[model samples]
Target: MTHTLNQPRNSTKSSSFRVDLQGLRALAVLLVMCYHIWFSKVSGGVDIFLMLSAFFLTSSTARRISRGERPPLITGWLHRFSRLIPQAAVVIVSVVVAAWIILPSTRWLELIDQSKASLFYQQNWYLANHQVDYYAFNTSSASPLQHFWSLSVQGQIFILWPVVLAFSVLIWKLFFSRFNFAWVAGAFFSAVFIGSLAFSINITANNQQVAYFHTGARLWEFALGSLLALALPWLSTLPEKIRRIAGWAGMITIVASGAVLDVQGQFPGFMALIPTMAAALIIAAPATRAWANPSGVLSLKPLVKLGDLSYGMYLWHWPMLVFYLEVSGNQKASFLAGTLLIAASIAASWCTTRFVEKPVIAWQNNLAFPHWMPSTGLKAISQIAVVAIGLGIASLSVTAWENNVEHRRALAASQTATDNPGATAPEDWDPAPAALTLPLATELADEWQTPGNPCAGSNNPDDERIMFCEQGGNFDGSPDLVMLGDSHMQHWSAAAAAAMEESGGSWILVFHPGCRYGSDADRDEAECANFQDAAEEYVADLAPKMVLTTASKTVAAPDEYLRSPGEQETIVDHYAEAIQPFLDAGSQVIAMRDTPRYTYSIPECVDSNPSHLEACDGSAHEALAQINPVQEFLAQHDYGQQVVSLDMTGLLCPEGVCKAVIGNVSTYLDDSHLSKTFVLSAKRQFAEAFKKATGWQ
Candidate 1:
């Protein structure tokens, strides 16, 4: 799938041109493109591609080994990557340039990081570490380079598979000379298949988001293909009628799997076998002249031609689709638009394959170096080095450009902050005219605050469910304040920290992304429920002087009216029960009302329509309820002045409107979380609120 149309050269008796397999490559790429553009569902095409890549790789390597020829591991790697990197580098460069011009500045840095990762074949791991959910279909903010994850996995396996085969050969020569190389290879891949499959199933069940890009979870698909390649000779000897049945059945399954199964949610696990095994059946089916042969349709001239362009097509389509969505501002493409995009991708791919892939491959095949360095291996290595240098230069160029943009933006933000008072700006104060928004869009991606220092020793909860971090705090002593709850509360830590530092106090931040501090029934996820339980216990035991958390959550438009008293009572009860432990421990609770949530990225919206800043402004009523649930909870409970609700909605959304930028500062990092710069701008307000709630000096 990564290097389609470049079947490895096989010198064995069983080695022959696999026209049918080439056509399968075409089908796989088409399925992937169509699914992404029209369906927004997984087609299991990527699984097929993984299997096919391993099948071809194992087939070529096994033949050489069985014939008593040493697998040309080093030369093979050099030649393979030399051919692959040039076209990939061209695409990466194109994407970086196009993304800069087309996508919002907010996405530019991430695109740069992903482009570099793609060049080095580490994109899968990068996505995995970032916890990107590939199944979450959001075309608006989808990365143009997301398709590279599969290519990265394939590229990684390309390096690992050869070494595995070489090791198998060395082992055979040393001890198991009596057994055939195929048997030894089969045993090794079988172990890989079982172990990886079990791991995939377990991880996908627990965290499909990470499992989707996990290399180990996907290795079993490659092993299944390797197993099929080893067993191909025996399979070819089956009766023609049986082979035909298996081949047709497999083809049908390949086409139908996406429609019939939950491929996106349950892939590279046991469910992935539907497509991988289907591809195997077709590969093992007898090649025949009969019209009934599945190969007849698969080996068609047009399909074979598409297979030749498949590698380039896979590289081209995603960025085109992403760019189209960005320019059109369409969530999904219409039929005609999708067709045009596909056609444009095909044209671009044709040009890349013709002008880029073919030339580099031919050059590699006929490469020559100075006579002083006459070794063929050295020549191969030189070709690889040339491609690597070119790719490195391109990546570094993008990095340098991004760094420059970031620096300029940082300077602009600093200058703007003096004039742009943000939330602290007076109701009638006129903001100074500025060229750039404070906390510029380029810097907005990193606006979500992270705890600067992790809680350690007795301060640390030692619980995986909750992330505990201490700031402006003496670790040896009990925290002066504890900040608890989800990211909604986490964003205000900047203000909390500033307030704490000013008062010569310390605070511990206890929160998990998307996890609200509430009753078990109120939490949807098991991890979040556990986090709530752990956080409650930790806060009670520590008994900090004050605990801060969001008391209410906002609902985004169109049904975003303020909740009624009855509705507020239920939410108030939930918070009262959750924070009762803190009250009993003589700790004051500061329950700030949650800030507004938006349906779309405020920064991106503002970036797109800088002139129409008012359009990005949201109704305050829609953002928050008129009645503060925490205030109601305080009135209901007999905790005296120990529990107090802080409402800063007036400061956040002045005059019943939540502006994207207040006095030049961007209001939010994305849609839900407030920018740290904006929060810090409201430092005076938070300090006053803290003094009122906790009676702190």
Candidate 2:
């Protein structure tokens, strides 16, 4: 199961091949499978895979080069990729088909992007750059291809490691032929290990989500394995009893690493050394070690067979689990479902290894297909051609499908706007069972005027106002409405725009992603602190007829709606402080309560639970304060007569339960933000409320 290049005809052979390594591969795959399916944990198994891959590749290549054989660079690359790509290609194709059939169309676009990333071996980069919360399955749906990140990392390393090996080969052949080549390789790998490990620690501490998928952050694990590969000969010289104890202890450490340590949250930082080092220790043990060695357990016939299927299983398991969750509407699978999924993954892995991988590897070895004349020393051109055509067709088809969906949604939105200028739906209308679609997934994106707005990221406190304005009605210049705060405030942009159009006013938007309107440092984002200060000054300067913002902010803690006592008080006090300046400037201030957040996406819930929409509904008491903190603060001590409070919770949580959908429209785009499609329907009601609160009409 350890993926490695084909040894050239003249390469040095091992005393005997290690079947124990194969067993370790099987155990690692099983650990990952179990952790993902049942434990909802990370077993650090992927670290073991990374280490073993590097160990095998480095040790094999080093021994050949040290023995003065030419590094079979061309044949090696072909063998390595051919062994991997064929099986990976099959799995990617199968996953695409399964996703198209089983997953909601809303997720198809993301799946398409992920499929391409996986196929091209850039999935880790894709996930890292996108800031995907790989661990937060409750709030964000797990991507079927998320597990491909490790495979992608390995693929990247496979390509890059060879270059380093080839460089080492050059040095050994050109200058270090008289010296021990192992030391040269060891020094190089040691440098890589130290450098990458330091970076991993720094980046993981700064941004764990990105660090989790960053290839740079994980390079040290592979480097450590390479270092171990250089020392394998010396390691084999250790006493038999010591080797046995090391192997057993290493295996035990790896098994316990997941259960006893916070591996997922802290890796691939220094903590990752636990599993990777353990794997290296096991690999360094001599194959002839006694039964006291853990290799005895690992090299059993059944485990060896499982190891043969490990690569395929690792590729196949996650998508199956994700598809099962999507189809079954379960956030987490039951024991029965998990068992069935594991069985399915194993069966698929066996078929893929037997029918797909073995044949491809054989064909590649035999050179049955002709190579392109120009791209000499590479695998048969036919393999690359087939993969490219397959991936290109799939990517374009999905892109076209997404474009068509977007075109239809845009047409629908335009028609809806024309037909209902006020954007109101019927009172008794309910969400259609099949209403959820791909367009609705990012429906809120168009609701904000921030994209082309001049006000975006305006941090200057003295700009003489009127930078980014979302004008709702024809204005000679005077502003009648202003929207301020973070995304929570921006969520109501559509409704506020509609209200402005109806009430005859120009509205200004001033917001950043995590910025609050108030100047309190504790409650606001440090990065956006200056922007908030500028926004406060700008709002006071404009003194629009009415200022609209939100009192809602997500607490820093998980599953906790109520902020810490100090944060809550600071937020409440800041709200008054924020509005006091606006009130003094004769602008009526209206602070709306934030909508309840849910643990899942509305569309995902609707897709999975078509017959039970109520399953998506959440308790207000759990997701929100019993009473609005702003409303309570205002009631206990009046901020000012000019400051008005609006509770539009009735629009969101009409029956004391925040419904996923209302009036045939999906209520939320994701976990907490209201979908623009749903918000559009409430424009008329919002306009009326605005008129009542501000007496603007």
Candidate 3:
């Protein structure tokens, strides 16, 4: 992703302009644009860019070290970053301003965060931690800055590879003076290649989403390039006929790999070898006129010129595509629109390269400091420091704006708490008017509730599978109440905590995000199955006075018909079997009916359609089954004495419609999860329902 337009200062004539390599860069960028704009798939182009960066970097550093010349570790980084930062800064600032103007207000804070991450070269880690699926193909919801992830990885390696080379040089001079430095470096990189590739394969198999953005998983690709650079001299000795075959083969493979392979799912792993090694072959291939080679096609002037704009084009293309999708309201662009997007991206790239990148590079190269500044390295450092300060100012401004927005949202929530009665309001009650909906769109991300404290002492489950948390009352012994299940149960934690506090009893929360509490054999997901087994075992052994969980699962509207009688029986049978363990332990079961699931995010829908709130409403009859599954299960079984089914359908949906905004509070955070604000507003209702179900004072 980082384009090395200029060779290292120690470059030999052999390292001079290679039209084929430039053309390779152009092809890589073009493939990336084509796949992203039209195909919605990974092209493996960024992997080629990463490998080529290491190819160039290692080629330069190893040459210097071999000649007994000290590598400019400090000044080199300063120079490289100083050249790179100006264009990146311009793109980031432009994206931020554009996002504020064009994107929904709900996305502004997230954009600010990603912009900072991108500017500081930490975007890959940020996205990885968030578990963003790079191949989601949801352009409307995708971040315009997501493509910066690859660039961030490149930036990190640019810093790291140099230190690695410097250390290799030190070891070579001290311990392995008899051995060639390239041999030593190659040996070290070989170990990196093997170890990192193994790790990449393991992690990718376990979690492809995280592996895609993981730096350590990607280190092997760069190491392979380093190895190729070290072996170039030996490779050039091949016959011209063989080199031509390899060159054409590599070029053909690089172009065909994206179309044939599942790059998105399998990359940064062994599958990455296909394109990266193909690139390696091209890099090692001879480009003479004595024999036909891929260079005949790749060395064309227009393609070579496109390579000049590759870096800028990479930066411009994604944002243009994302914004185009947003403005046009299309899932995927038409071929004509995609072509125009590519053209606009190329033009923008040209402008940035011409007006921003070239000027900065020229200024840095021609820097003439005062006599007092003795070292050119110091002048380079000064330039880098100026860029750093500019980035710092921009980051601080964004942080201040984010803080102000959060403060205003918090103040508005507090002021309207009384007006927004939420689920506790009577069906016929008319609420007071408010300026903004409760849990404002800007604050929706924080709507998922948590217990705010992890379980401790005897209350904490020994099994790690149970994501245990504690709230309410003093933790002296076992919890008086236990809440178990997935996120559907998590949303009720606040209300449960309030009830426990009022009753002077402690409660433990045992949750796994998407896993329901039931028989492990019934679940298909291995992790969720394991979590369910552990949670059931932990809760049954602890034997709390009461256990709470979701009694049924709601499907999104349009597919919301009630289950068949046999399906209902099977569902309740699982619940009854799961609940029998708690009943045998002398714990009462409170099975609350699941909340309505919508086809779209409630908060987002409400945010975008505030004037026509009814458009965001859903059919209550369709949202919930005709008969409560829990009630049917109780009637069909003999557990009614201990198992109590609590249905809040009337509270959630009034007049046969499930309104997104109830009593001025945004009911659901996303499509299925209830907003914490709405849940907390329903605390009194929850407490009253608990009293009625248990006959507790």
Candidate 4:
């Protein structure tokens, strides 16, 4: 037992401890880098590392706490955080700077927004809400910081662990002070591991990628290591045979997890148990056992070297892989090239750790603060200072880019020849009178709810409408039921007609791309408002009972061009003001929420990997369980605006997560918008919900 403590790392000829563990790190990192680059698989290397991290940190922590020598939680957190934040900041700030310089104007503003979220460690949520699809690859715009989702999840674990450990030690001291510490830690690991497994399995099935990224469900892996550390005596006593096999077995599990798993395969589910348990076994295996000796394999020098660079390796690899894909256009590549990239990543990571992470980490540790200051307080101030500096730099770069970078690049008019016309997609089409996506049909339902645009005045009343015909007659058949709304209703046209026909009735549906019902753009647009005033007078005369609509969750939707603070606020307030007409009219507002949108579309998914479900996006129900800002907003509308849902709560989400697709069918036509086929399949489900809500069969 004392041998491990006695084994000081030599500059040359690394010990069993160093070689073996570092070797494990190398394997884990290699797997991850390869999977992300060429294998195109869900690499569980990060998961394995996370498990290892929990074990190592927890084990070390228990020893300190047990000796009644515990340091301040905040101090420890900042110490670890310091090791991480600087490099992360560099990557993030660098990405933002590079993006500002390299990306086109249409994406510049969005990149800036993503940078803000990345800095705050909310990239996972940013990606999940904006990019997750059950059957699709996350082909969203490259944010080097997207990899920080793991960092955020880990940071969350770090933030809460110390407090919990302190409490656990206290409780144990009071009741079973002399009782085996290992057992209590074991209990912690077992309970948490089980919970995580349960959660991972359940949520992966349902499509809640964000929740899966939540720290609560992932804490157990780290806790398992803590438990192992507390009970090191039990491990030290184990025979060589078991220890050797376990160590090797753990390595195999991590490799398998990284190389084989896909998006549909539940992670952190039963599948995660393999990597987590393997990690547990590695931590629990003693230095010199007979049968499954950790000494012979894990304690190698090259492995030890990699372990020293492990932190930087983890940070650097993902971004590099992404950058490679970005540069190469995520193409089909050779295994040999992938191997080289992984090697290059390892080399680059090592360099980064040595030059960047190590110096800052060492400096932070060596810094001498005022005698009166608490260590935690000094560390907190330093971290804030670091963050402030990064933010300042990023802000300055963005401002410079905004000034230097050209906007609109000599507009379409300038590009056109005398005979040719510069045009936008859907230029010839007019918005359906009651379509949701069309600006005129549904005045941006919630001004604060959308993104990209802030002014809610872009709808064209004179545009021709593109119809999907949800519940309507065939081309030769007479139009009976006319359904109208944005993409949500348009996608329903094909299915709605089928449902009506199945019911011995028919419908004629008209679809508008962005128009929503019972909403008006009149107040915000001078010309449109006048047009709307006259139209409202007429529409007041022609109300349609069978109405379909949508409200988006993009935050500041409907608002457009949003140039200044006054404009942003005015546009938001103005859109909020637009909801008055729907309340005033006795119009049945079936304000269907906008389907969840992924960061990218299917074409990219197909281009990236033709074989995987990444090519097939989900069912309408799978796309989401709940509505966007519309549902919540409708609850507070002036009048009792009767709003009915597609009953998407449980059916749309299972185990607390919603998917974009299930089985093989495509759920959305664009982003999170569903296709008519999906809407048709959902008829029975939506109908049941609708009937229950309105009591009309």
Candidate 5:
């Protein structure tokens, strides 16, 4: 539930009474809470809140402008944002402090970054631009503020909507004064509604992940509500029976939207009309005493009160769920635990709304110091100024403190010698060296260097290309070697670049996230199949002497492992089929064995238990399949004697033990991929294998 906008009840001409809107707010927030905590599904409740906010905002602005009583733009903005920022700032501050106290240091940087983004209401853009998988169900470990993406969208619209209304007012006065200001504004908003809807549909189809948080993609929802605000007068004049039916239909639609629609994949698109239109119908419906009236159902006292606390409820529920998941160490809690969490969140929301939100509202209303000030605007600005300054200072202080911690770690790293240096694997060596320090792990975790990766820009999963040319590779007059596979291969790009530099060769990397070198059938998606085909064709054309790639892949489920007899044969066949084109074009294939894939984050584990590093280490047998899947595959498949299978597992997991640190270097960056620093340390061994495979000597 990315979240909402606030509005005064009498803002719209026909919405003089808004008990129904408040009830709708209650319904929307509850659906979001239920979906987030237990269902892990999208509820389209957020779309309704977004629409309602725009309706209120546009109607209020239109009323002010139509009356020729425009308040100072800055005053209006400061007042609106002041009301919004206080509770959000408190939540952010509480979350930051709580995360620091409870979460691992490895998660601190990201949490802090998001906490800051949440406060400034830019988290949606940050999440979208960073390509964060916002729907990922990492309840225990994911950022609590991830849900703020929706709130950030609403906040941005809050800032811009007024400006748009102001511009429309200027246009109406200048060229269309004869027409009603509300109607003139409606025409402009209608145009925006249609144009934004078209863009939203096109973009969501192409990249739904980014589209989910994109401001441009969501503007149509807001515009739709704004247009509805203008249409309210006519809508209220509809026959009594039709209005009652419309209200009932809207209510039922809002309740059922989550269960019926595929919101996650097709949201903010044409499908979004289900909830937004439901909300519009309800908002348009005139009040009635009849039981069939949606307004009657929504205006119940308890529901109306819940609506009053909806903003705070929305704010508190996600963080509470996340905190519950983290503290309990459970992915999904029992029904009882979820109920407790919801109860706790509701209590917290009530406290926030009653003690924090209402008081601020009262205080802003009571201000009398600025006699020149027209209304609550000055008081709101004053409150915002204080909160902004305090938050800014707090953020700077936290940043400085975190920087100091890193600085100390860097200094320690510089003074010490890396114990293992990862020179060679030994049978009897302790994976953790006495001289190896925590700083080394931090350094290694930070050093996942990749060179010439094509998915470096704004390319989302489907748009990622397979080919990436090394810097100066085309003009360096060096022999070309092509590297390919998934993240496993991409992780070794820096080391491969180093080896090529020494061998007077350059490399091109052809990689995709989960698409390793395998047959089209083994590929995860159509995009992966396309990438595999294109990469094979590209490599054949280049006619490189060697095609370097990795054969190690890890599955999250234990049942998915290739442990049975002849299981590795399937892997071999798939790999051979995928790489046959390259081999057919006279290129040698060198497949490196994968590193150990850990169950949890090695850096995070190490960070949490610095003194007991051994606890972070795992059984090598469990981490790796008994048979090297690739080696077993290659044993039977003949690509002449040119295809070389290399298992340097010994270099990484010496003596059947995969530890967090090796030779003073962090072995794995996250769970499976080798840290760039560790890989670079093993460059001598890598080069030796390369020479043997390519016959480069």
Candidate 6:
């Protein structure tokens, strides 16, 4: 089913009437490569490629349906899929091996899980969640299949378009042969297209990065392409001069989408119309122009050549760039350097297409045995089912090859010592006095929730206090410390209880899981909106000595979330007014900065690369740059001799970059928060910083 794209179908073909669009494919790929290699500051190339994909697919299918021919959708799916899988397999296997050497054991396990899902084409949703912070010019890390969100959209179209198209064909067959079902299909698709675009526009107006990677937000762009194809009959008959003008207009739109738009702009939303229309015009252009030939500007030698290998190049480029950036510590891409990398990617793709993709497909094609009959076109896909199963089994068998008693023992031992929660219990610094301990950790019991820290607090007041129990004993054993914050601060109590154990601090960790440190009257994200008044009253009654917390700085400044400066100041002051309790209590306050976010899921971080060791060697500067703006809020605070900083700057950083990885392992469990492995690595550094800032020593 995997046809040779370079070698056009010779067995049975449509006459050489016109394929002016052949040149357009070359043009689209060129735009994409240029944007990726040098001007990711712009996404014109991506827009062009997206438009072209919809145009070509819908047009090709219309031709078949127009003739009353029904080719099985599975054939095209398998063929297109086979064309890309081999190279993907190699990249994944390489990433897995690299991770084992360079990344921490926790990240390694996650990568394996993401790899299996990606292998089956489920990376789009995985990446959608990632796009929340994925395209921030300052965001670090990238998914190997981040681009595949486009493919998933296309694949979904492939399945759904047929049902819609087939139904339209039936209407044409039964109602009237001369029926223009194109208009009907166009109208229906256009409705969904407009509706989704409206939704995307509303959402993206608030957050463009999330809109960029979300499928629900983007489906309309592809629908625009399909609608364009359905309009081809009218377009092909337009005056030659008008067609040329439309082509020019389409080109201009694509360039504008990339060059004129900023990350803050609502994109592939209402702005998507610019490029989508442009691609359709370019594709539907007349063949009369000399520039429209495969050998001309549209299909110049370089573009046509590269376009042939575009599928492979797109598949492998991001992962390679990530690995390169990780090991070399290069964040910005130079024009010449990026071009060279793109060329290298092209070469690698060509080799993969020739040796791996072709041979495996041929083997499957030629497969025939006495037990099976070839009743299907060209080759029976069912006949090759057994071989596919065998290959799957082989892949899994290789993955499980090291399953042995000793290896199991080593894995188990590693998981317990390095991975188990209790192994890295906070060093109790009990020499300190009771009044000095933090608000959250002073009260101790056995309910501490960070998995392994043995000491925790008793949630039940009636039950005897379990204070300072994890580190052996509470030397002075009174309960007067009050810890106030989110779940993160709650987890740090083990260390706090230890610090206050001698004359045990009267500590109680009053935390709401998603609860932020910011005051009510603001809606950054409520831990539980209904509990606002009740919780604040509860805290006031407790009247703890101090308040320790961590949350988004935006919680205290909602206007900062938008472009209006005057609004930011007014809103921030109102927000701060909501949490004036601590100043009244005469309590010392400590505020931890929220952690930086990663672009990919924790698992995708591992699956995207082949070598974990190389991926693990990234810098904190590159990873944490987005949060530099956060310093602005920190500087504006009015609290005196309070508001201590628990910085991860040095702990998460190495050299000049701040990567998601730390000490040969990814540090984050999700977008921004630290994973247990990463948190422990930073604990020693955090303790020292805390002591220096608060005089807790």
TM-score of 5: 0.83
- lDDT per residue for candidate 6 within 1-697, as digits (tens), equals 2222221222124453233344455455556556665655546455555555565566776777767787446666555555445556665665556555454343433345456556665555666564534454322444443555655555555556556666666666687667676766676678868888888898788767767766667767767777877887787798877787777776667656666766346576777767667777776776553774322355454655565666667666666665555555567567767777777777777887678666765675666655554446435464245335533643563365334323544543444232332213243422212111110111112233443233344422221211212222332332344555555555555445444443345455555565544545434554344344444454455454455555333222124355332122211223344356755655555555544344444433543452542463343443343443324555777665655555445555545544544333444454444554445444555656666755664
- TM-score, one value per model: 0.85, 0.81, 0.85, 0.58, 0.83, 0.66
Mark the regions of model 6 whose C-alpha exceeds 4 Å error after superposition.
Answer: 1-22, 98-110, 137-140, 176-178, 292-296, 360-378, 382-479, 485-491, 497-507, 511-538, 544-697
Question: Across residues 327-355, which tens digit of lDDT does each residue of candidate 5 receive?
Answer: 77788868898788778877887887778
Q: Over the stretch 1-697, how does candidate 4's per-residue lDDT look in tens digits?
A: 0011001123225332334555566667666666666755656777767766665566667667667775347666655655566666666666666555444333455556566666666665666767543224333455555567776777667677777776667667788778765566566667776776677677657765654565655666666656666666667787756876787777677667665555345765566767767766776665553334654565566766766666666666666665566656655347776777768767876666667666765565567988887976776777666656655665666566555433322232233222121111122543232221211101112211111111111121232222222323332333333454445555544544555566555444434444443345424544444433443343233344333444432222223573321122211123343334543555454545444445454323422343453344433333333334545565666535344543344444445443334322234444545544345555666656555654444
Q: In order, what lDDT does every prediction score?
A: 0.80, 0.72, 0.80, 0.52, 0.73, 0.52
In model 5, which regions exceed 4 Å deviation? 1-17, 65-68, 288-292, 370-387, 390-409, 412-415, 419-446, 449-466, 471-486, 490-513, 518-556, 560-571, 574-591, 625-645, 684-697
| Residue-by-residue lDDT tens digits, candidate 1, 419-511 | 767877776777655557767777775688864587777788877767556555554478888999888888989888878877788888887
Per-candidate clash tally? 0, 3, 0, 75, 3, 43
Alpha carbon lDDT of residue 359, candidate 4?
Answer: 72
For model 2 the local lDDT of residue 50 reads 90
Q: How well is each residue in 437-513 modelled by candidate 3, as lDDT tens digits?
A: 78877777788788548776777687777655665576556677889888888988998888887887788888888
Look at candidate 3 and tell me the lDDT of residue 52.
86
Regarding TM-score, does 1 or 4 come out ahead?
1
* Model 2, runs deviating above 4 Å: 1-16, 66-68, 334-336, 365-422, 425-439, 442-444, 448-452, 456-478, 501-504, 512-538, 551-578, 591-600, 605-667, 677-685
Off by over 4 Å in 1: 1-15, 62-69, 167-195, 198-207, 365-382, 409-420, 424-435, 442-485, 496-521, 524-549, 559-571, 576-591, 626-645, 689-697
